[model samples]
Target chain A: MAVYTEISDEDLDGLLAQYDIGQALSCKGIAEGVENSNYLLHTETNFYILTLYEKRVSKEDLPFFLGLMQHLASSGFMSPKPIRAKNGEFLQEVANRPAAIIEFLDGRSVKRASPQHCGLVGSALAQLHTAGSDFKLSRKNTLSIESWRPLFDGCKSGNPVELTSQLLSEIEGELQYLEANWPSDLPSGVIHADLFPDNIFFLNDAVSGVIDYYFACNDFFAFDLAICLNAWCFETDGSFNITKARKLLNGYRSIRPFSKEELSFLPLLCRGASIRFFLTRLYDWLNQVDGALVKPKDPFEYLKKSQFHRLVETVSAYGLD
Target chain B: MAVYTEISDEDLDGLLAQYDIGQALSCKGIAEGVENSNYLLHTETNFYILTLYEKRVSKEDLPFFLGLMQHLASSGFMSPKPIRAKNGEFLQEVANRPAAIIEFLDGRSVKRASPQHCGLVGSALAQLHTAGSDFKLSRKNTLSIESWRPLFDGCKSGNPVELTSQLLSEIEGELQYLEANWPSDLPSGVIHADLFPDNIFFLNDAVSGVIDYYFACNDFFAFDLAICLNAWCFETDGSFNITKARKLLNGYRSIRPFSKEELSFLPLLCRGASIRFFLTRLYDWLNQVDGALVKPKDPFEYLKKSQFHRLVETVSAYGLD
Candidate 1:
């Protein structure tokens, strides 16, 4: 779903010569990452990932993301550590794009989520939040609730009335509600705002690593938990599985206990997370180009999810014990 | 450019259990190969290529392609060897597509071909023809001269007069000339008809491997050489580089000497090869679908190439000694 730029062999050789890694055996563009072009680089001795930040990623925000990964790795969190060159620089230019090499993590993303996988993911997320607390660099989440209205307006011109009429009114009502009743007392820290199932890898029923930190930013720690509730606790048939939610919440609580205030606003935070995703998906759906590699995910899925979150009135409804 | 089917984690574990290879550490869909979805699979022990043949490839031709790779590898050729499962089957189903795991080859495909690279490729190709001579199975080249006319007709509907009018007449003239002057007697054997630069891998000015035997078939061995002349001896501007051609021919002659008759028909064979690729590219150009991952290569490049080949009247024009 990625690989927008083709890296030349000469460019690759020059890039690798700056590092301790030996000659590259092969460098294949990996079909994962959506925001950056990723190559699974194999050298004579080891494997690494070569990432070229595409136009979608902000160049100014790279240091924060890279430094955050390095800090987390140094803190014994399982994440890909950025490999430095002989000059001690981690970021360089490859094919005129900002590129870097990171140590390849050893695991695969699980497709079908089991309760055990959910538990491991939750524990890892909490650990990430805890480990990143002291990192010097911080970034604001660009895709937060404040950005959703503008994104929706960008897509308003192209969509049909049938698709937008109900969606628009409901979104308006929800945005007003969120603005008036937003929580202000919860602990704020670095949060992996987009830690879906695909971003977490597992080996032997344990979390091996966390990945795709492009959305990592200074946000509510409990908001990250709320994002996971919407992402992990939902089934394909539009029903919420309370068992998965229970396990995930328990796993997270074991690391850093949630405060009573954090638990009380979980339902509202989940609703906000649903709207954030629904608006983005709707924008992408409305503005999809002719030859995109990845298909736009259906916005209706998140709309139905928002409707479900709106029905939940108490924190215990999410299966938190 | 491939990966039409998604393989789940449970299915992957089940597939690997059938082989002696250990647990898969990662299986990334590689943005290489157009006809098949290829994953650069890494296990706890070694690396392998997991290929899921896409619909563009004929299922009935799997054995010939896989068998050719196996036969050449056993004969000390550097192509990837098909890894057999414990049940002794090399071809199996994964994600409902015919899939096989092959040993990973080291070395990267070069973007710019040096004369030395061309020389090594020519030498390796001659060795491949020699190694495949005794293989039991045989496949006819489906994209041979007989199919060019039909392929042209498929594209004739959409192409503009500026691109097709003169091209049509010239192609018709070349086809007639080639048909009348085609050699009736020559050394016939298995040949890799599509040995483009991308299909040949190089390491330290030496050929490490040859791959993509999907187009291997029973054909004139010299035709393979002629295909390489058209493929490897051309610059980006459509001019044939005589120095590179000289090295390539010398390298091939060093291994398997060509007959005088074969050399005499080389110019005609090169023209035929050019038109064969040109028609196919034109067909793909006219029939390209929206949202395809890979862009269609320019058909005009091959058209220009065919025009260049049409003007060459003797073998020496291709830098034959």
Candidate 2:
């Protein structure tokens, strides 16, 4: 509701004039996101999403996030291509906030998806992982398993549940298990690290686009598959739907099959994704300090999710294949 | 690692002088926290936590966060008392970071807790809820039940598995069930909205203290019990540990007995806690962007755990008359 610092109509038009996508028709703020201020705009020619950087995002990382979108768009993946300003920069200052306009993609998020739809999502993700492989960039995953130990240190400040020792020991053991058995030399590429249900859009039964590249970074392709497995494959009852998982893996293999190396590490990657989100969510929950615009979601949920995923070992996923 | 700005030792000493505790000790940077940069500073006087507000926290809400700490401290709760600077301000500019210092608490987080420990936690929590009943403040539970829709909105962005729609609808039904059956006038107090294992501390097999009141706000005390039931009473595999629940309830009742109204609301409150954490975790998992020093944990574990808690519509803990 704080429209005080948002971009006005005139400024929006001026920025759109620089892009080759014709003139602007209409633009309005998206009321949903807790992190950034987004505007869904309908231009004369094409739809677009205009986003203003919020406090949680760093100005320096803006280029990577924006450029990756542009890169992915040009690479044949369906996404909002970052528009350049008249000055040829993808980023511009509007309303004193770092802003950019991206080609809006049209798709409905799968509602009552069938197994076929889940398979398609898996296939689409695999293709995306393969497509992003050659992109020239290096973004070290900040939430990698190595970082888990340092973050565990914060839990020591106070004993709300004395989980630090248990969590740390358990996590350390997981890390050791992971280090001993991590999938190395699996097709590395730019990964959509946050490829949850919201980031993928479906045009009818077909995947029109995968959106939200802010968490996109260079990593193993299978890890992205693992992320999809946890997000797109789990049931509402928290049960691992193997029927959905099988279809998904099949769909992924149709585009780009997981090598033995990648397949071997699927469960660990699942654990990593699980633990990473768990720890972060817990940290956010306990800290209880967030900017006005950014609502701090509870971290305990993620911790719980990770713990659940840890129960599934590699043997469970591949099943002595 | 990104020490974009530096804090002088002298500047810190001035900040430390405000606390009425003994003498100063050493302040060491805690490398972990994803949201804020925290340092453990021990003095000849007492222990304290010096946190430099990171990009995630708002400068405007510093007063709310800082004042809440001071207020709770003054009200004889276990919270860090923010020290006012020479300018009579608790907020200070440190290394281009809006920072404040708080008292470091003693005790260890219970890692390997037994049914007895959970019982102690339950009792301490209820007593704490009683203590916070008359605290002067009206901060809304920003992460309340109403916030679940937006989280679901975020989750819906992706092509989740075939049953996602089923799950969402199921969750919506659960929310409505809670709304209609919600027990009003059930002992309102300042509830610790986030009461996971990692947040509570213990010492010498006794309840040492409860810290982290950022989520503390006016809500049903039964909601607090539900949160604990979902957190402590669950097994490692996320199944409901019925015996542990009895122990937890017994322990809480020994300190502060639950009212008839409170008892009736536990089943519903448990469901609410389960869904709340479930959706929040899923949202965080999907929305995770990069360049964070700390990791964002997954919410699925809590969601899964909540799903289990949701299954038991009746339990002996309620002592159904």
Mind giving the per-residue lDDT tens digits that candidate 2 earns over A1-321? Answer: 111245554576567667676665434444324467776555656556778877767787777788888777898888678878778899987767888887766554553456787888888787777667666766877777677767766754664555556766876676677667666576787888887766776654688878877777777787777777777776766566777888888888888867777776777787777767766666666665443333455565555656776776663553234
Model 1 residue A49 distance off true place after TM-score fit, in angstroms = 0.4
Model 2 alpha-carbon drift over 4 Å, by segment: A1-5, A9-25, A111-113, A158-169, A179-184, A290-301, A313-321, B1-321
Q: What does candidate 1's lDDT look like per residue over A102-164, in tens digits? A: 989988887789988888878898999899999999898788778977887776775654455
For residue B47, give model 2's deviation from the true position in Å.
59
lDDT of 1 at B2: 73
Task: Provide a comma-separated list of chain B TM-scores, one per candidate.
Answer: 0.96, 0.83
- Give lDDT tens digits, candidate 2, residues B148-239: 77767767766343336677787777777766766667777677777776566665567555665556666777888888888887777766
Give the whole-model CA lDDT for all candidates, comma-separated.
0.87, 0.67
Candidate 1 lDDT, tens digit per residue, B255-303?
Answer: 9999998988888788788888888877877777666777888877877
Root-mean-square deviation of every model:
1.9, 27.0
For model 1, state the Cα shift of residue A134 in Å: 1.6
Residue B62 local lDDT, model 2: 67
TM-score each candidate.
Answer: 0.96, 0.47
lDDT of 1: 0.87
The TM-score leader among the candidates is 1
